[model samples]
Target chain A: MSIDAIHPDWVAVDWGTTHVRVWLMSHDGRVLDHRRSDQGMGRLDQDQFEPVLTDLLAGVPPSQSLPVLICGMAGSRQGWTEAPYVATPCSPPGIGQATRARCKTWDVRILPGVKQASPADVMRGEETQIAGVLLEEPTFSGVLCLPGTHNKWVRIVKGRIVSFQTFMTGELFALLEGQSVLRHSVATRGWDADAFDIGVSQGLDQPHALAGALFSLRAESLLNDLSGTAARARLSGLLIGAELAATRPLWRDHKVAVLGGNDVAQSYEAALAAQGAVLHALDIDTPTLSGLRAAYAHLKETT
Target chain B: MSIDAIHPDWVAVDWGTTHVRVWLMSHDGRVLDHRRSDQGMGRLDQDQFEPVLTDLLAGVPPSQSLPVLICGMAGSRQGWTEAPYVATPCSPPGIGQATRARCKTWDVRILPGVKQASPADVMRGEETQIAGVLLEEPTFSGVLCLPGTHNKWVRIVKGRIVSFQTFMTGELFALLEGQSVLRHSVATRGWDADAFDIGVSQGLDQPHALAGALFSLRAESLLNDLSGTAARARLSGLLIGAELAATRPLWRDHKVAVLGGNDVAQSYEAALAAQGAVLHALDIDTPTLSGLRAAYAHLKETT
Candidate 1:
């Protein structure tokens, strides 16, 4: 169908563990409106998804019903429905589809997340964002890093997400400082950038010993009486160092682009800068919208 | 106090969380008797420590009363009393002492653990084990790896601990496979050494990318349908590989010795072998005893 042939509205949903966001767009694919709910897929059981989705879409006109494309953790085994995984080095063009969930007047389809070999990692909604990046910058190439709770490093070639990797740096940091024994020894303030830099240098210099370095944070507190912030920075360096060791090979020769929340992205930028790599930072939210829009566009073209 | 003049019967206590081990040693530190109780320091309130110790030693003859040396988590802040940390590059002669605990005729002293700067990590009981190694093989010098929940990579010169580092490799592996999102994507058994080697190589080659590589385990499983054991092996490789990258620098010119539980020690051996490092595996239990004995001997001679 041609773009002008249908009066359908386009709805894009990025449903994750803690938040649900829906974007409304016109037939021409321009965003007409947007709404977000705190009822993230992470907090709800499988059965409650449809009702929550319906409630979120309550005020829309029936005739303006659009094909909704959903992504993120909402399509995992524990999600509303399990979306099949798309193999690595593959792009949104090859992303599998969720069996469409039929609302009374609209057809709703969730976008499948991408998976890859090589380093071996998975992504849910981020793949869509990558797809959007590809759509917006068709000729862009090399490594795209999406940093967050589970940071991802995607390799794109000629607009395809040929391969990617993920790191649990954010999660590990949270657990160690907030949940582990080191919590007692650490303070809430006083982050040392120099200490962080030291960690980065050590991490890049000696990735295998990164775990051992973590214990040093506690030791510094007990032995040298380092401030809590320095300990926190040390912890960040340890994580970043391990990350650098793991990802250095993948992006060795490639130009890098970091995509994610601001603080995380900045940290990644700093890490890349330390290695003397060329890098670019893109807004996570914008790329996500563009990715969702691209998915809708692809679906429209295919059907 | 000469060994010949000391009384014949005394207590050797390995007090830790979850379990208490008591060895009734002869004046010369021979195990004349041994017993264990579940009343570990971890389960008791701080004020209850003395009473527990007293209750456990209730029936021992007073004439055989000897000095008691305690080790492990019992000396942590949450345990009987906080044993202070000793700074790194510490020799047998430089070991710190815990504030003494006295009961009637029995004298108690907790062994202090070792600490290091740079990465800022610490360890308590392991240094004693290093001391034990020094006692058993006084001429040996190189890297000693004590692997456990928190693995220590220690440097020894002559008979002193010059430096050390700790890794939470075991803990991370357990958390990822048992508690994280990747848990369901991996298998419970069937280890693949080759896959692990691949992970190690990747980590070494791209030390900076370690974090991004971790996410690949789930992605590989989702896209390629990797066997659970293979997935698990990949996970191990990623972690071990990262560890190798971090630690390799320290052991570049040094001989390597591993002290740990058999299986874990074996893994460390395999990783080090893959890196073409000379390695020695030491029994963790025996070394700990040797370390305790060494400490006791040192104390006896000095006092």
Candidate 2:
């Protein structure tokens, strides 16, 4: 809590669509102070990005003109500055590809995102997270499944991102369970492992019956009084199962790492485990922060 | 225009969730005067049904106490009158099964819906549509593909709905286009036949790639300057192709009737036709009206 003791070396920011998290770092690679605001890249106009960051940093007075390393959607086209994506079959982008943002108060650099050319895939902030993963296990070569609104599955070999694909599974689940007609049938909060497992099984087994499977949830609720909790779990299972149906086979025998500790992430863990996948998992913030820190260190070394 | 010349014997109404469509019928099965309103079953309270119908019929005064035969969501449990579902492998319900709603001005009959036991499927308004199809072809023994918000695929054997499945394709399309992230990429209007065909081909050929396929639309738009019009059409094609993947196998060679002339229905027709389906198309209102008239006549003959 002693702000005077923290003459921070630099700052790390994960300025995504919904939130902007700032972390003041000490010279010893430790987080001296961390704060976040709802003023994400989504909330700010092109001109407001610098001011927003300035306001977000007013509390933690970093004595020196520190380098402000930003990641996530802040590098997107609609973001504060367009950090052009570095294509696949390459290592996670470092400061070499980081795009500089014009700011009066600080040296700001936004990390570049990764993109796949053929299947047309792109990820902005997740690239930093991948860089963080590589920091922990530099030679970690396999697949990384990052579950979120737009779930990303990346393939890595010899510390380089080979190819990746994005699935709107999380967003689809939210829309279907909360906004769609199935909203009437699904519970807001509850879990049933059996129901989820059954759903996953159905999703894996029935490739041509997704529409019917979705309708069946409503129908079962109507006909046999299927509980809302079960329906919710079942809905989750169905989506994850379908996602696995798309991605699991190629990596069934490979080492997979699922990120985060949320219920959705756990659901994926269980699903992948159900499908005979030995998953290596990580906590939520470790990778993003690590990636940012790694980027800062790499920048210093290269300079 | 001539409400005076039309002495209606009965009234037929398709009061679905969103709109109330009323047809004034003569004793000889002529649609003398027809009217409709936005006061659908979804908007009305249990008590409001009578008044809504009364308001919808205020202009066209049928001379006598008309036997109002209503179908669609008006028969749902949440609707005006709860006309419970009749299990599959039976002809569409008639007066014997129609639940009479307590109305002072009219003898109101809400027809029962059809339900499947195994896969757990139900249809309210769509059953009436199916019955209407049967009215046109009494000995119909094929699959009926009714494309709508919840698209219904019914298997008809000896004029009975033996089995049926419902898909949320239309609803999903609406959500993905208007509400989801892909909304940024998808055009509200325009068509590209080539894009649609390619999407359809992908949906049919690649069973394990829906999520990637969907995300590709946005990525392509961002990375490859994929046009919005083509994206919209491609979106439609992908959904229809997936639906076809689920259904086309069983009923590919079966005599198929695609009802309605909406762009979505036409897309389905094109997709089905692409998959070698020689489709039998029908104008929208005929089958529904015929189904109601046939029900009325059957009610009279049985009485």
Candidate 3:
């Protein structure tokens, strides 16, 4: 169809702290148009969300009250509408639990996040992604290793989130590479697979020595002229491997679905594969879109 | 003696990254006068160090070619004089190995630091402290735990530094407490010894689970309304405990001399005590001053 020929049935949004993405979906799940903005929930106050969303959608030709489905931090307490979290051992909240955000022209539904009570943990946008994963294989039971700023290893059995854990590995890598003293030694851009592998081994085998290991990067830089690229790669590997060491129970003997196709995910996949994890890679987009679709279907059925 | 009645026989200066301290020493090792400024090596360029020192010593009546003994990062490659480091398994660099800076009036001698070639570790200012510790007990042999921005664990055997390791524990704690997401949950002030003890135990016992443990602090704050003070204490304990876990060989089954009277050193002392470490707390100023005295004595003998 020509760009101007078709109208969107519903809008799927992946809203987060720093950015927001919108996909204009047709009735059959085709993406008619895609849009994005830096005006994420983190940047907007409560009242500013609707206006920002409305402005971003201004290019869309008028259609009869489009249904807008939003997931992620936008449903947080600081978001447009607070969609309370659903405790774990429960399915990712579907349309029935979706909260409504008041809008002048569209019926907006926001998916709730998931929360664990003891040893407390929470997930927002990823819950939608989880629902999307469930959409494709409702009967699938395995662990999902979602790699991001705060990497989450979620255990799933027969479609409900049994439990999950988060590791600050990605954030640590960012801080160490960009802010810590190691910044001088670690390059901003480069790849060193061998160095990465060594780092992973060190981190996994001698996890206790992380604090000392970090200082060694700077020491090596000063004493042995360690290349910045190698230091950077090693930093990444160290953090990821440390995370894997901590989260070993989640994926050690289980078949795992590695989410996303990003560099971080690939690194996680490699590290996991090195550990003899039976793994499969999934497109990062598949679960989010499908999750939104699943929510949309639920919204239609319940209403 | 009155301030104006006594003239310094020599000057001892400990210059570090963020601050510089100067002490006018009498012929018999008495501190005639003392001064400090934030104009540390990290803040000044090669040329600025002399000017800053000159300005600070304006109050001291200039005598004929006064000898100045300097230590710390001021001898770094970026400092006033590039005093090369002495490799380990040797005594802390004394005045015999001091480097001279081309200052106008003062005979400025900057003592060299110590370096470990194999593990790639180095210490600048703390070496002066080590020299001072050795000055008091010349034949003492044990481990010295120097806590600061970068905590160092040094093994001294019969007046020589056998080997040492640096842990980014203090730096990591600062970053996590002040800059990381956990900052939102941790308080800037408050104390909870019990919480700290628990964190230390957890960190030591499950050293590999540190990444997950850190995230749990934030989660606990959000879900359980965990107190900020407790979280802060726990965070400190966890980082220190992790460092202890890594450097167990340095302190375990060996007598450890815990340097510094500050909170950081005390924290390390307490954590080490919990690990059944044989520790003796020394006044923070003792080693630095003693080390400077020892170097000053050597300078007199040489020059």
| Per-candidate clash tally | 45, 0, 2
Q: Can you write out model 1's per-residue Cα lDDT over B152-261, one digit (the tens) per residue? A: 78888887788777777877787778767678777877789888888778867765665566666766676678778888887888777777777876657898888765
What DockQ does each listed candidate score?
A: 0.44, 0.72, 0.73
User: In candidate 3 chain B, where is summed lDDT lowest over 10 consecutive residues?
Assistant: B1-10
Descending-DockQ candidate ranking? 3, 2, 1
Candidate 1 vs candidate 2, DockQ winner:
2
Write the residue-wise lDDT of candidate 1 on A88-140 in tens digits: 66656422465565455556677787765555567788888888888768877
Top TM-score prediction, candidate number:
2
Q: After superposition, how far is residue B166 of candidate 3 from its true place, in Å?
A: 0.7
Q: In model 3, which residue pairs have backbone atoms overlapping below 3 Å?
A: A132-A291, B132-B291
Shift of residue B54 alpha carbon in model 2, Å: 2.1
Candidate 1, residue B64: the lDDT equals 20
Shift of residue B131 alpha carbon in model 1, Å:
3.2
Instruction: Give the total clashing residue pairs for model 3.
Output: 2
lDDT of each: 0.73, 0.85, 0.86
Per-prediction TM-score: 0.81, 0.94, 0.93
lDDT of 2 by residue, A115-191 (tens): 88998889988999999999988998889988999999989998999989898888889999988889989999989
What is the C-alpha RMSD, rounded to one decimal, of candidate 2? 2.7
Ordering by TM-score:
2, 3, 1
